[model samples]
Target chain A: MALDKRFIGREYGPFVYTIGAEKLREFTLAIGGAVPGAGTPGEPLPHVSPLLHDAQAAKAGPYGDVIAFPSFAVVFAIRPFSAALSDPEMGIDIQRVVHGEQELEFLDVMRPGDVMTSTGRIADIYEKARMGFVVVTTESRNQHGKVVVTGTWTGVVRG
Target chain B: MPRTFQTGDTFTHVRECDRYRPIYYAGASGDFNPIHIDPEAAKAVGLGGNILQGLCTLGWAVEAVGVFVGDPGRVRRVRVRFSKPVRPEDTITFQGKVTAIQDGRLTAEISATNQRGEDVLKGAVVEASLE
Candidate 1:
């Protein structure tokens, strides 16, 4: 079944996510953003090799606390976006979909401990040569109701 | 001091995703799609093997911009199309060329290619503050 064009304007929930430091640190390390040494600066472990050079200044550098990577918003927004797109009511098949593109606009930096509420919407739907495309956009706002980031995910579902 | 960028300025950064990159990205990004984390499942689906998350590749491009701007927050906007699937152990090279720089903002045309010279990302554009 093709993705329903009528669901283009459908909106999803305002899911709340309280950012955690451990998650941030994990993402940082996963993206190779950890401070050059084996451990954070000022509190280096004695067991770490002293020959380790400061490759990327993660800890003792700028961005005081752990900050989310540019694409980290996906962790917070994917669930709600998935729920919105995979709804049986939407008549969409999740198994045949492939990510086509992405756009992210960072309005403000997201730090650990910040609480954010994310809302997802189907921005557009189009079909081409037996394939269906759905553009999902998510807007995440901070505790103060300030927009922190906006991400657009484009999924192409093969017919 | 803010760095001044001129049109045509170019820089490139490369990142090689290890065999476990997809799994780590799946865990970190919460995108556990079979094609991204399970090799067998990926092959069954015709993907040959587990592939890296598109967002993770985008993160590398963002990191390149961060290195150029000296701050990640300066990246105001990033747009890119995932032209090809990035498999594990694929070395992605992110290249950028300054297309515009005005009013304390810089815009660049970016592209990424795999070690095999295949275009993994196309029509990529990033706008960042010149701080």
Candidate 2:
């Protein structure tokens, strides 16, 4: 079944997320191939940058603090896209959905204590080769009112 | 001394999707969708078994460029199309080549492939600031 075009312009949020130092380390390490346990986010892999996991080292680096890995923005920036997929009106079958594509632009580095507010809307709805595609565009602004990140998230609903 | 990058410079990064990596990524990213954490659930949906979140693969693509540029914070943009699912134990290799550089920004095209040489991500591109 095709998604209702009526939901094309539906908006999802002004979702608020506060960046924490530990969460930043966790996310960076997880994607950097660290295995986490109850008390640790695992040891940082060789390729993992110290600026991302070591607070002291980061404090001495250019950013002056540990920074979230660029893609860590997705941890919070995905709020609106998640909302759209589970929105009852959209009636998207979660089981049949696959992330088709993704694009993210980081305007500035995200650091701990930054408060980010993100809002997004369904940018388009169309069928391609018998599969339905839902495109959502999101903008996240930091507490300083500066745009920190923008994303284009696409989800494919398999027929 | 500042490192110089040219239009044809290339770099590579390799990562393995260990059996529990998807579950660990799910915990950190807050994407607990059963397809990523539950093998049976994924199989029920016709996926061979549990699959890693596409965003994780995207992250690796970004990591490749981040490593190339010598700083993760310098990575400014990344775009990717998920061509196939990455299953547990699959090792992915990312090869990136600088495609352009102008106005203090550098752009690179990246390719992500699995151990079997199957492409898992298509048209992957990343941009970073030189300054």
The best candidate by DockQ is 2
Question: Residue B110: error of model 1 in Å?
Answer: 1.0
In terms of lDDT, the poorest run of 10 residues in model 1 chain A is A44-53
lDDT per residue (tens digit) for residues B58-113 in model 2: 99999999888889999999999999999999999999999999999999999999
What does the lDDT read for residue A123 in candidate 1?
92
DockQ of each: 0.52, 0.90
TM-score of each: 0.88, 0.99
Q: Show the lowest summed lDDT stretch of 10 residues, model 1 chain B.
A: B21-30
- DockQ, 0 to 1 scale, candidate 2: 0.90
Model 1 is docked with a DockQ of: 0.52
Q: Among all windows of ten consecutive residues in candidate 2 chain A, which has the lowest summed lDDT?
A: A1-10
**Candidate 2 chain B minimal-lDDT segment of 10 residues:** B61-70
- Pairs with steric clashes in candidate 1: none
Q: Write the per-residue lDDT of candidate 1 for residues A1-159, one digit (tens) a residue.
A: 466688878898789999886676566556653322334423222221111223244455555555676667778877566886678897765656778888989887787789989998889999888888888899999999999889898988876
Best by TM-score: 2
Regions more than 4 Å wrong, model 2: none
Please compute and give the TM-score of the first chain of candidate 2 against the native first chain. Answer: 0.97
Residue B81 Cα positional deviation in candidate 1, in Å, after optimal superposition = 0.5
